[model samples]
Target: MGALEPNAALERLYRETGWTMRQLAQEINRVGTERGTPLKYQQPSVTQWLNGQLPKESARPVILEAFARRLLRPITHSEAGFPAPRRGSTPQPPTLDGLVDLGRQDMDPSRRGVLGVGLFSVALTIPGWPDAVGRMDAMRTDPKRRVGQAEIQSVKDMTDRLSDLDDDFGGRYARPMAAAFLVNTVAPYLKATASSETRKSMISAASLLCYLTGWMAVDEGAHGRAQEYYVKSLELAGASGDRMTYCHVLRGMSVQAANLGHGAPAVRLANAAAEASPDSGARMRAFMAGQQAHAYALAGEKTNALNSLREAERAVNQAESQGRRFGGFSSATLAYATAEVRHALGDPKGSVESLHDHFRLRDSTDRQRSKLIFSSLLAERQLQIGHLEAACTTWNTILDEYPAIHSGRIDGQVRRIPSLLSPYRSNPLARQIYERSRELSAK
Candidate 1:
């Protein structure tokens, strides 16, 4: 789907400069090297460019530098760029363009501030946007290459595999790779020819990948970028006419907002998810209820939080009756919500219980990164309960996994252990735990 020949602007501009394609490619590599990153563009990549190809975004600055040196003038992509599919008939050009630009922005080291901007583009969710999706037309493109179920299926399979990698390690492990996939593969595919049905299917698959990528960004502690991806994911889901997936992405955004202690926005977003959704499944309802509980708790609405928790429990019970155990609404989410609300409400003992329940849901093979967080919370709760010995014991478990969990969030958790156990410095067990934790922290 990628080798489209519409880069007329780039080809014509390069031809005007009268440099051989190989020479241009060499100059691009030299510029890239001076910029502290090695690029491997050769004659073939350049030949393909003349034949209609888009260069990688990361290669763009270097390419432009090489061109400007020959032509002796500044340039921009709009003047010397691969032409996107004409938007004259495509209903999805804007969305596809935004996503491609996002990937490109992420690739440029100097342009990183926008990606990390924590401000949610609340303007995107204006009053009529939900209904606005109805105006979109999916049957717009006519490409030389055909995209179908097979290509979309590949994306879904990749999403699943990358999800497992994210669960086991951390989001940083695959976050950039996922973004690269979106830029280098998915973007071009979206521009290819497909029927309405195929386009929606591909969009649906792409939305899932975006959501997973956002989830990893959260895991990477890049909350701003995470929200950015989630917003786009929601938009793609809406374009696909899939309310369930849209609500799912909304819920993910609510979680991050709540985690950031922005209570009002979190609650509002969660409620919006519920109101905007169609007839969601029991598990989804349960997940929503649980999310509401956490958001309310963050807002200091204890009574409302408790009621939400009760509603979530009922929803989960109903979901079990429907033979659903674990997907998005799995037990882990409920336990984590309970622990968070309990802790927020200053019920340390109950928080500890819920935290332990959450851990029980994970076996030995589960991600150690989460364990590091849950265990740290457990130890803190034990300290709050005045069980110094138990606190130290939990800290020991966290230390065991500390060396294996290479995450900034987990690092923050491990670094706070000494301060948390400071009161127990006189206790033998606490002293031993503190020394060990300090040793691990040093590593």
Candidate 2:
């Protein structure tokens, strides 16, 4: 091949970012690691790319993502001077069609291995409200079928049942059922003709169900799959003019990012959710502020995190005084958020205190799965503070409940029990807990 010309397009974008070559390389490596594939690119590799040497196809996405995150906008392959993706310029399928396809693949056992490979991307392009609102393509209508309130209510009721099952049993047992329902039942309802009012309501209901499915996917440790479902939920929510669901889904995505320790993306997503929130009631404010506080804490904005926490506290108080509850956010939720903020801000003792408050204030509305996860967190934090006996007691509580929940997240916590106790094995209680954990994990 002839000697290649420099990639001036990429060089221009690089200049726009104000990132040194090494900084750019470091950013790419960070994104690669976030995508579950670590890289060790140095200035030399970035120099090659700027000099017109092509990066491997896998690395191209990481490079573009680094630029996108730096520029706070979407960066296309062509814009980054990379070859167009395989699908080239073809538009994505319409919302309903895409949802059906995604759900079908999720529910299919043979196709699940492929789905599992999708990595959570920190640079994933989040659709802004204006961009997503009413952006759905005209769906094909089945003239023979027209949905009414009955159909909408049926969908809502089914979502509630599925959610309850997820809270009680675990997403591992509930997600497949949800995916199958989405493909077989909800997909058909989306295509059915209906009055404009009924159509919008049906779509809104579908959006909630989609969001719940994504939440379950998160619980099952399917982060990439969860992100896809969340995007679809946002599209549906916006199409139906349901700002509430849209904001809720965005907040859920933020929580996922924060849990995964992607602080910047978590802050961005949480702020977007709070910004897009509709007419904020006290409870709504608390819901948004609580997540914002956690995200800000994770991003290391100490002042912002504390301010957000204070705001959430005031909102929760206001909501309680008014005997009003919206968005299922309560004092208990705020306490949990406080625990997260404390933990992120490097106060494990304070975090433990807040966790205790959380459980004390928790009502029946809290999911059993959350109880287990937070209990595990409490134990880990207890261990961190040199309270080995207290930590062992907490672990015993978790073990008592662990057998009933089949969550990938909870299972991960259980797997950590032995290692967490290994240093304290000389203590009888710690040794006993460690042995118990080994036996339970073996099953």
Stretch of 10 with least lDDT, candidate 2: 85-94
The segments of candidate 2 whose C-alpha lies over 4 angstroms from its true place after superposition are: 1-93, 109-114
lDDT of 1 by residue, 197-238 (tens): 888788888888888888877776777677778878877787
- What's the residue-level lDDT of 313 in candidate 1? 81
- Writing each residue's lDDT as its tens digit, candidate 2 over 232-284 gives 99999988999999999999999999999999999999999999998578888
- Report the Cα lDDT for residue 149, model 1: 88
Every model's TM-score: 0.75, 0.78
Model 1 quality (TM-score):
0.75
Highest-TM-score candidate: 2
